[model samples]
Each structure stands twice: as structure tokens, then as C-alpha cells.
Target chain A: MLIRRPAGVVFAAGLLVIAGGTAGLLLTRHSTPALRPPPAGVAALPVPTGPIVAPPQEQLDKPAPPVAKPVSLIIPLIGVQTKLVTLGLNADGTLQVPSTTAVAGWYTGSPRPGAIGPAIIVGHIDSVTGPGVFFRLSELRPGDHVYVRRADGTTVEFRVTAVQTYLKDKFPTEAVYGATPDAELRLITCGGVFDAATGHYLSNVVVYGTEVD
Target chain B: MRIVKFQLTRWRVTVLLAFLALLVGIPAVSSSAAAATTTGYVALGNLSQTPSPVDVYLYSSGNSSPQLVEPDVAYGTILPYTAVSPGSYSVKMRTAGSSASSTPVWSVNLTVKAGGSYIVVPLRTSAQAGSLQVIDNNLTTPSGKAFVRVIQADLNQQKVTFHCSCAKGTAGDIVTGAAPGTVSPQAAIPAGPWTMTATGPGGVGSLYVPLTAGQVHTEIVISGPDNSILIENVLDAAGAGVAPVGGVSTGFGGTASHGSGVPLPWLALIGAGILVTLASGLRLRRRRLTAKG
Candidate 1:
């Protein structure tokens, strides 16, 4: 049987999941004896508070560098290697979906890949024709690798941290789109049961990743 | 016994003294570390009629030295909040990509106060002259208290009143008939979810405003062809200020715009189930034949 909770309850549950994820990060850091302390200068910066989560070490070492446009994305685990296209807000202010089913769209309003904010990329689960590029996006597991090649000839690697499914009505818009202090990635696709009557998926599957290099 | 008791008392005194020293010295050390550089936060916004991008500079001195703070700020876009020190600053605005030696289109001098947070908007004056619109920000919310401030920046609207439909009851006329460039006083209300209603010369509209204890927020109602509410999560010591929360539409329209439909992938599931069942049936038949043979 399918159960539907209030939107507030769903949002709170998402937050709990995210909180558990960061707590696990802290635990892993503490358990690893080989982890080195931050450099003298980095140790001096004010401890990040609030929504601006401190980036992992690789990102902490670099200040706000020149933003590089992402040219391509490669997720080997899901056999996804597709070029990225820029997307903007629609007339109604919602994100514009990619026109082609086989292509993924990155939101232009957010920072580009390898930048100091959450760079959002979204794809359709399936079009009227067939399955889309991110059809198997939900198959991705934690620790799966995602590579984004930038126009500057550098590729930023991200490690998957969490994958969550939320009903479209209860989607945590702020958590998905809000600004972050460090470089992050959110890959989204429509998932859950498909309704023939509505012709739209009921939920969105969001894959959260942190830039490793 | 007497000697042991005396030694124990001495040890307890030493530990208490150490704890007292830490209690008093921690804040002193931290304050002294940051007291040398007094600072405040400031954000920039562009709300001019022109569509061209603007380059904003802050001159601590006269027009001699200019520090380009925000560059290529497109119309209707707001730059991030930054820290600044208390001083007399001359805000200069010019066409983006223009040479530093070129003349600025407009300039305004502001005496910034220490620890003050402000939103500086480059706007056209009543006479159509370029000017700066400074909105002072309040980041003080006592425990279990939240605040709401209204800004009427609708040029065409003659006046607007901000009403609140809060949990306990409705508070009407929180901001009564505020004009352009007018900022309503920050009103303290119980921290919770509020449906803020802004009725103006154009029409009436409402948006959800979630408030938490010890958090302050400012809502600016802008009117024109594209009317919207801009919510600023004012910076506090707790964390970095949230990026400008936009897309709060407030005009003559209902806010029920979300798409509706429950999806059921029963056909796919049924197909998969049938395939699995047929495969298992074939395997069972083959096993029975082998056993019988």
C-alpha cells in the first residue's frame, strides 16, 4: 500500500536524512588516523555556520577561483556519458526541462560546475519516445564517481553521498536549490510510480554529491 | 586526616580558579582578536529602468580611489552580501565594462555605521535621476521572537498595507499605507509561519513567510509589470545568510500552480512480475522432468 504524508513531515524527514549523512562524514573523519589536520591558514578561517557547509579539504584549499563552464558529464557506474546543455528558468519561473530526452540540462541560475555553490543538473526519466539519459540515475549508489569536464580543461570529480526520493508535491525546494558554501552537485530525475492518467512521475530522485577533486 | 583535608581543599580551589579564568578569558580573547577590525555587512541590488548592467564602486575617500565591489550587476539581479567597515563611502555607479577613468553616471555618499547591515539598490529618483536606495536591515530577534518588516518599492503604487494572518490571530495594518522608499518599522511577533498579505494600489496578494526564533527577515514588495516579493534572510552570528529567496509571486492571481498527478507504474511492475513467474515455472517443469527420467 502507498502512504502519503504531509509535505512538512516529508521535508523534515529529508532534513533528518541529510543530518545523518553529515554526521557520518564527521565519524569517518574521526576514525581515519591518517587524516591530516588542516593547514595553518585554513585552520584560521572562521568555522562555517548555517547553510554554508564547509567544503571538503580539496575545496577548502582553493579560494573562490574562476568559474569554469561544464562541457560534459561522465557517470561510469550508470553508463552515462553525455554532453551538458545550459538551461534557464521558464516563463513561470520553474526550471526548463531539456528538450531532448537523451540530453541533461544544467541550471544556469546556479553556479557552474567546479564553482563554490550547488550546481544543479536535471534530466527526464523518460520521454514519450523512450527512456532518457538519466533513466538509470536511481541505480547510482553512495561512493559512485561522477566526472564533470570543464571548459578550462580540468575535470572535477564528485563522490555520491546520498540519493533521496521525494514526492513532487513535497519536494524540498530550498534544500535542493539553496546556496551552499562549497561546490556541490545535484542530479535529479523523475522517478517513483508512473501514472498514465497524469503522464508524469510522482516523485523526484535526487542524487547529492560533493566535489572531491 | 587534617593534612589530607587541607590538601583536598587546596586542589579544589585551584580547579575552581582555572574554571573561572576560562569562563572570563574566553570571550575576552575572542573579542580582542576581532575588535581590531570593526565591520558590517552590505548587499547590492539593481532595480533601474534600464536593462544594461551596472558596475558599482565604493570609494572610502572622495572620488579619487574607487574599489569596484560589484561588477556587471544585471538589471533585477542582486549581488551577494559582503563585509565592510564603518566609514564615509561614496557609492558610484556606471555602465558596466566602462573604463575606470570614465565618469560615473551617478554617485551618492553614505555614512555607514559600525555593525550596520544594509541593502543598497541603484534606482531612479522621482526626477529620473540615478540615485541609491538604502534599506537598513535589522538582525535582532530575541529568544522565541521573530520580526517582519515591509518595504514599499512599487513606483506606480501610491500606498500599500502589509497584513499578517498569523497562527494566533490576524494582525491587519501592520504597515499602513507605506509609500515608495518607505520602510515599515520592524514588528516583533511570535515565531511561526505567517501568511503575509500586501494590499496595494494594484491589488491584494499573500505569500507564506516562515519565521523562527532568533531570526529576522525583511520582505520587499516590488510593483510594476512584474510584481514580486523579495525575501532577505538577514545575516546573523549563527550562519551565513541564505541567498535571496525569490519567486514569491504577489499579484492578482491564485498561488495554486503546482502540477498534480499520482503516478502508478503498475504496468511495468506487472510485466516484470509475469516474466519472473514464467521463468520460475519453466525451471520447475524442467526439474520435475529430470527427476522423473
Candidate 2:
């Protein structure tokens, strides 16, 4: 042989690594993770008391930094990437959804991503044409990562904690829209059986996450 | 004789008119007293070495008569807000059951505003020798968060900054530059268990506080037993949760009825990729064993 035996073996090994990696990517690329049980909403902690004696010296968290507006969102788990549009309340007091299924939106009424409040992002499950930006939203399982790119060109990562499907008629307004004790993110879209008569879905799929980085 | 009778009749008419005027004046005085009073509120706290169980009196501007507002309030005690008519007044501290004529141990000129709430406390030394600190209590509960402001009443900690000590907490000072007798500006904070710390040149102190959504807290850094720095929590408002403004409306029904599920090519590609990986793994294992042999 023109090449040494060791070199030939090494070259084959490199090819195997590449092929195996590509295969692993392809296998997980349009797949969904197993759905987990819905997560309970944030809980209220017990009130703490002041010291009866002199308190000990200690350090505390620094002041929160100013955060810029978010521009886009990416969820590699279910293959979602899109520009974010600013959303506000409609005339009927309902939250505005994205105009087109190709994109998603962030609610202006809620705090921005990375702020110490529940940030809301909404998308469409499907359109008349085909799948929407969040078509595989239900496929998101716990431990999945969602990255949000901010106006300042920085990114904040969040980890999914739960994915829940709630009937539209009985939405938990406070739990879904209320304040949490920490910075959190909520991703919403349509789910459940589609109503042919009304041309809408009977339920909504919501994914809850907290800032991990 | 007729002239004399006419004079008598004129005198009687004058008396009748005077009686009618008196009847009208009585209701005018009564209505003014019965009308709605523009009122504010005030609470008392004894943080100084003031002897406990003291009586508090309010003397309105230009009025000498005193109104006994709070009585028998002990040291380290903060009285709840009491309704008071909005006006210029003076608050005086006296020994419990002390006669109104007795000299006051501590007094301050307090002007209140309608619909406003306030807390007044005597700081430093005995009540007879200390000054008063007026704290504004008119604060709204933050939406989906808690609101807090610290009162620097510690004997040694002159100026301090407070923040939460937690990895999951929001960063930065919750309240800064809080000095003795000065109420810091309101700060909106995350609702959670917080190990709050106060830091400054005078000294540092730690406190554990659990704040809930839609709450307003007043952190008073007072002198503890044996002159140790202590922190106290005074809950102003504790309404839970937040207001609901909007809900989600997402998606159209076009693809929902007849599901266009995952395409076959993608699945086929995934299967092929798995096979390729498995074959590669087997070949690598065989090659490694051959080398070892």
C-alpha cells in the first residue's frame, strides 16, 4: 500500500467520527422528546423575620443591570428560529398574536427578557398554508434550551421547566400572566384539537422556563 | 294713641325677624360640622429610650385643647395608622394618663395631607431629649412584585445600602444611602425569600425576608437588645398576585384539521443516519481489537 497502515486506520477513524456525528444530528433534528408532566406555578415562600439580636455582616446580590430589548429567538430542540415582533393588547384586551405564522412576537406589556419578571413570547402553531413558527412547540421537553438575542447583541439562555396544554376556555389568567418570584419566560402557541367550525384550536400550549444564563 | 300702638307693633316685627335669623344660623353651623372631613392618617412608633406606655396628643393649629390620639404606647412599638383631619398640628408625647396641663416630654409640628398615611417615631436618647422622624407611608403595591424602603434607625449604622443575597435574586441595591431618620425611596423588587443585607461604614447587618407579590414592606434598622443592630419588617400592604390584562390568541386552524405530520423523507434520512453511525461504531471496535491482538 502507498500509505502506512497506521495512517490508513487513522483516516478511517476520522471519517467514522464525522459520520457518527452527522448521524446523531440527523436523528434528533425533527424529533420530539417525550412529554413530561405539567409543572405547578411558582410558589410563595414564607416571610422572613428581622433579627432579635444584632445581625451578622453579610454580602448580597448586586443591583440588576440594564437590559436591552430582545430581537430574535431560537429553540434548537424543535427547530424554531425567527425574528420577534413587538406585541401589545388588542382593542378587545386580548394579547396580540403574530401577524404571520412565519414569525413570533414578544408582549410589550410584560417585562423584557432578562428582567426580573415573567416575559411573554407568543407564536402560531400552524397557518392555512402549513406549519408555523412554533408548530412543534408541544415537542419541547424539560431541559431544552431557548436562546434570545437582544438588541445589544447579547444573548440570554433559558431552560425549559415544563410544557403544558390548557383549554382555551379555562385559561389560568393569574398563573399564566401573574408575577413570579424570579425572572421567567413563557412561550405560547395553539394546541389540542382544531375546531373546524371556528377555525381555531381548542387549547393553548405554553412552555415555562427560567433564565439559566 | 294710634302712634304709640304703631311703635309697639314695629318693635314686635323687629323681634320676629331677629328670631327667624337665629333659626337659620343654627343649621349653617350644624351642616359645616357634619360635612365630609378632608383627612390624612398618622401612626406612632417609639424607637428611642423613651419610657414605655406614653400618651400621644395632637394640638391643631391655633387650638390649645389637645386630642388624645394614641395612649399607653410602649418602646419598640409602632402604632397602626389613625385617622386625623388634614391640617397643621403638633404631636406631643406625655406620660401615660398624664393631665393635659402637664408639660410634654417630646413634641413636633406635624402637617398632614388629605388621604396620605404617615408614621412618626422618636429617635435617639429618651423621648424628652430626642427628635422625631416622619416616614411617608403612602405607597402602592407593585404589580407582580414587592415594594420596599428602609428606615435608618440603627444607633450606629449612619448610612447603608441594602440588597438581596441569593444566586437567583435580581442584582443591585434594593435601597441605597439610607440614613438614620430618613426614609429611602421606594424600590420595586422580586417576590421571593431574600437574605437582605445592609452595608455601610457604620457596620453591616443581615436579615431574612420573604416578600410576596403585591406587597409593600418597610425595613426599619433599629437598635436591638444590648445595642446590637437589628432589622424589623413592617408590612404596609399584603394583597397577593397581580392584575390580569391580557391572554393568548395564537394560530389558525388550516393545518390542524388534516394534520400534515412529519414527512417520510425526514424519517428515512434519520434511519439511514442511525445505520451509518452503528456500522461505523462496529468497524471501529473491530479495528481496535485487531490492533490489540
Candidate 3:
């Protein structure tokens, strides 16, 4: 004698069987196909004769030029000789500090000439522990000599004309770096009496120089 | 057939559930997307009188990359842009199609929020005269008197003439024919767009002042040991005074009179008296000698 099953149980059993079948079919269809060797005597397909787009003539004619490397600085008067890192303007419009405290050089803005218009070079008077490069920056007197070696193997010489000390707040920015018809050089470093309270130097020692030639 | 019906019913339920899930997720995605966008307008201030093309750049916080907006626009023109997820931003304004020599004219840090407006005020260039005082002693006499006249050589050329006369008396003494010593036009003198030249005993100097509509050219002459002449709005249409170029002289016409080509009555009278006394003495001496003979 066959026992009558509940309608829900019958429906559940039917749904499970259908789901299993569907899943199995989908899995089989999606399985990776086996690789087969090519038939003997099969010829390779011919490449289509389509229009070949030539790359831009200008780009092909002239290869991309390499970038120029920065120059190094050596000043015998102040006893500074080191590689200079480019510095930019800070958020507050003040100059940015060089990554390396040993030597810092300014990026020539449009108004300023490359190695002209009083291109400024700055370095630290002292590092965290002791005296660093440019420690004797204030001692630079008039008529001192400064040398800068360019990447192209040319060295530019300059003569110091004046050395001045100015309070940081009263820096003569325009007078020092403003428009100039001739090439000039300026070296700056922290100076004046050191203040224990503030780590920053109170004054800036500026050495003004003109090209030797 | 029963199994097919059960399967069809289960599939429909699953599809319905998926549709409901999509409906629920759509609102959340839309809200977040809306929150990420910011809309605002930028107001440029203090533009030049003439329209100049400027490039506007927007930068994200501490990001070196800048998005260029409004490649070019006339001066005083406002540009608006949309940004995503507003925070601190820097605006760099530069002269479009110009070299770095035309470095960015304006740079400022702004904190922008979702749906907020920002205003940037640029500093305008202004023309100013250095100083407004002159010094010329030859122009100022010991009597403290001087003479000044203004001559309009051209529609725009106004020449100032300063003269000091020692014959006028002490440094403070006023000359009879001289006016108050200041020369200014009742109305704006339309001088050609050239500099005004001022002449005095000391020398001649040029002044640059912008001339504008409904303006007047005026000359101000000062009389004293420290003599100065001031020209206001000489070139500036906005009414800025030209620096006073002057001269300072020592006191003129002192007690010891040097020959100034002026005939002194006292000197004449003293000479005449001396001549008369000598003549009378000679005549008396002759009469006494005849009586004795």
C-alpha cells in the first residue's frame, strides 16, 4: 500500500531536484574545453591589408630630449661646497626649506633669470647638533669670491659686494630679488644673536654679489 | 509536472527578492553620490579697469596637481566650477598665454564646503608719487617771498615758473605784481598725454600724473628758505600729487648789500653829500687865501 505524502513535502523534493539539475548543467557548460592539435595541411590565415596609421611625424622625427640636471655650488669665501636642491615657495609665500639642510638653491621664477636677477642660494648656518655648511656666512666680506659649477662643465664666478644683516620680518625681498638688468647672486643664511626661546635665527645674513665677468 | 511547478515558483521568489534588494540599495548609492559633489561660484575682485585674460586653477588639499578652469576670461569676469568632495583648496590665477614672467598674480587658500560660494579679492596695482615737497633757496628770498606762474604750453603741458627777487625786501616780503604763487587751472587742462615740466631757478623736473575726465591741472609754489613747488594730479587722473622737486637757498639781500643792479637812494645821497662838502671846503679855502694876499 502507498502512503500519501504531504503536498509541501512533494513540492520541496521537486524544487531540490530541479535546482541540482540546473546547477550541474551550468557547471558542465562553463568547464574549460580541452585543447586539440590542429588538423594536418591547415594553412595560416592571411593578414588583412588595412590602412596603417603612421605615428605623428614630429614625435618620430625628434626623440624626447633628456632633462637637465641641477648644478653644484662652491664658495671659497664662505667655505661652502655642496650640491644644491631646488626650493620653492612655501604656502605662506615664504621660501621653502631645502630637503637637505647642507645647501639650498632657489628655482628661478619667470621674472628672475637663470643664474641671473639675483638668483638666491641659501644654506644652513648650523644643523641640529653643531655648525654646518655656511656657518661663516656672516663673515663673508666684500670682494670675496664665489664659484658655481654648472652641469655643462662651465663654472660661473662671482664677487661679493656687500654683506648685510636684516631682521627676518624686515627682509628686503623686492630690493634683493627684484628686476635687475644684469645677473647677480645672493647667499643667505641664518644670523644675528641666537635666541634660545625660538629655534629660528632672528636675522638673515645676505651676501650680495655680481658676476665676475 | 508538479516538480516543474515547484521550481517555477521558487525561481520567481528569488527574482523578486533580488529586485527588492536593488531597490533598497539604489537610494543609498544616490545619496552618497550627491554628497560627494559640490557646487559653487567664484567672484573675482579688484580687476583692472581694462579687461585682461586670466587663467584660473583649482587644486585639492596638499595636491600638486591642479585642474585648469576657464582657460581665459576678461578681467573682472567671474568663473564658476564644480568640484567633488570639497575641502581645503588653492586657487592659482595667472595671465593666460603668458610666460612665467607673468607669474600667477593671485594665490590663496580657501576652505570650500558642499554648496558654498567663495570670493577672491586681488590686490590692484596703484600709482603713487614719492614725495610732494620741493626745495630751492634761489626761489625763496630772505624776505620770505617768491613768485610762481603756470603756463599751459599745450592742451596738457603745464609749465610752472618760479622766480624769487631779492629787491622785493626781506625773505617774507611779498612782491607787488606777483600772484599768490600757485598756478592751477580752473578746469582740467587737457594736456597731451605727456609729462608736465616744472622750471625753477634750481632746475627743471618732469612729473607724471594720470589725467582723466573732468580733472584740473594745478601748480603749487611754496616760498621760503626751503622753497618747494607741488603739482597735484599732474598726470594721475585719480588725483595723486607729483613729488615736489625743490631747492633751498641761503638768505638773499642781507645787511651787507652786494650789488644787485638796483639803485639804492641812501648810497646816492651819501655820495652827493660827500661831493657837496668837498666843493664848499675848497671854495672857502680859496677865499681865505685871496684875503691873505
Q: How far out, in Å, is residue B76 in model 2?
A: 20
Candidates' TM-scores? 0.40, 0.41, 0.30
Candidate 2, A1-213: lDDT as tens digits: 412455445544544544454444344332333533322221121122221111111111222356789898887656677899998777766788889989999887666776654688999988887889898787888788788878877777787877777777766555556543335688999876566667777677888776763
Docking class of 3: incorrect
Candidates sorted by DockQ, descending order? Answer: 2, 1, 3
DockQ of each: 0.04, 0.09, 0.00
User: Using lDDT as the measure, which candidate wins?
Assistant: 2
Superposed Cα deviation of residue B188, candidate 1 (Å): 1.9
**Model 2 clash tally, residue pairs:** 6
> 1 or 2, which is superior by DockQ?
2
What's model 3's overall lDDT?
Answer: 0.41
Which portions of model 1 show Cα errors greater than 4 Å? A1-213, B1-37, B50-52, B62-65, B123-130, B224-293
Query: Which portions of model 3 show Cα errors greater than 4 Å?
Result: A1-70, A110-115, B1-293
Clashing residue pair totals per candidate (backbone < 3 A) = 4, 6, 29
Candidates by lDDT, descending order:
2, 1, 3
- Against the true structure, whose TM-score is highest? 2
lDDT of each: 0.57, 0.64, 0.41
Instruction: Please write out the lDDT profile of model 3 over residues B197-235, one tens digit for every residue.
Output: 445444344455333222222322322223433332211
